[model samples]
Target: MSAAGGGSAGSIRIDRLLVYLRFARTRSAALALIDTHALRRNRKHVLRASEQVRIGDVLTIALGSGVRVVELLALPPRRGSPAEAASHYREVDSDGLDRKGQMTIGASSPAPGILSGDPEDFS
Candidate 1:
């Protein structure tokens, strides 16, 4: 129930975009990049982190070797978990999401300080 580069015209709140950007692992990093003027919406530089984004809006972000363009799809009211945020938009024909599936495979790990050694060894 989503389309990329094409969607029913609608307005999406700024908070939702923050969640989506976080989900994409691009918000925090994008925020830093944006500070350097590396992000654009519809060809216009986006300087504010709280700006609202609407459906069908094209977002161009600078990647390591190239730029990525994403078309906003649906908009939700509040930010959700990574899984929920992903449901809000469909990635356009861009390399930005090409490694998405690969990323989920090794996404999480045990806490850094957690140990599985013998309990008696602690004594």
Candidate 2:
């Protein structure tokens, strides 16, 4: 396979991609999303779950109501904790905000849910 963007000799592999996908909690989600034609790499639609991914490559994954574009920065040989996995990729510039001026689905949200429930409700 061809390694573009100054990729390291051992950085191109499907397993590495899997590690990132799992880290993102999207391994199964991404696979199912791919089957529905909801995933793209470098702007081209990708259907294979085992396709090799390289550093600096852009991955656009279709979410509930929007898409997220993540730029690969490094490809490690094995999976690690959340913090370690986060270092594997970088959010691309165009990956933010949707065309409608709303926040992209994957962008961080203020703490989930409202704090209106009664404190005594919990055991």
Candidate 3:
């Protein structure tokens, strides 16, 4: 609606969300990613760039080598810093796809025994 961002919090256009979240450099780039047909909303294929995404909606996006599942925590008001964009959503564990997009959760962690807790975290 306004220049700042879309008004209200009901929904945001898919292409705009990708741009606001820094998933793509620009709106066109975001559209390209959508055209790949690898974007899934709640496990369903995203067929349009104008799809509206609201809070708590789960998205499975196929990145370069792996898939990333992010839950919409909030809609960003603008394309701010990386930290600001990160705050708008939460990265959640998907259906157990490892670094190479293989199932390995039951057997071991992604790095083997280094899961759950952070090693360099001293806080």
- Local error of candidate 3 at residue 33 (angstroms): 1.2
Please give each candidate's TM-score: 0.50, 0.57, 0.70
- What is candidate 2's CA lDDT for residue 46? 72
Q: Which candidate is the best by lDDT?
A: 3
Could you give candidate 1's per-residue lDDT for residues 1-123 as a string of tens digits? 222211334554332364444422334544555555655666677777666578678666554434446676766645466556557666567454444332111112222221112233122
Error of 2 at 19 (Å): 4.3
Clashing pairs in 1: none
**Worst 10-residue lDDT window, candidate 2:** 108-117
lDDT of 1: 0.49
Candidate 2: C-alpha lDDT: 0.52
Which regions of candidate 3 fall more than 4 Å away from where they truly are? 1-4, 7-9, 95-123
Per-residue lDDT for 70-122 in model 3, tens only?
Answer: 89998787888777888999888855433553332122122211112232311
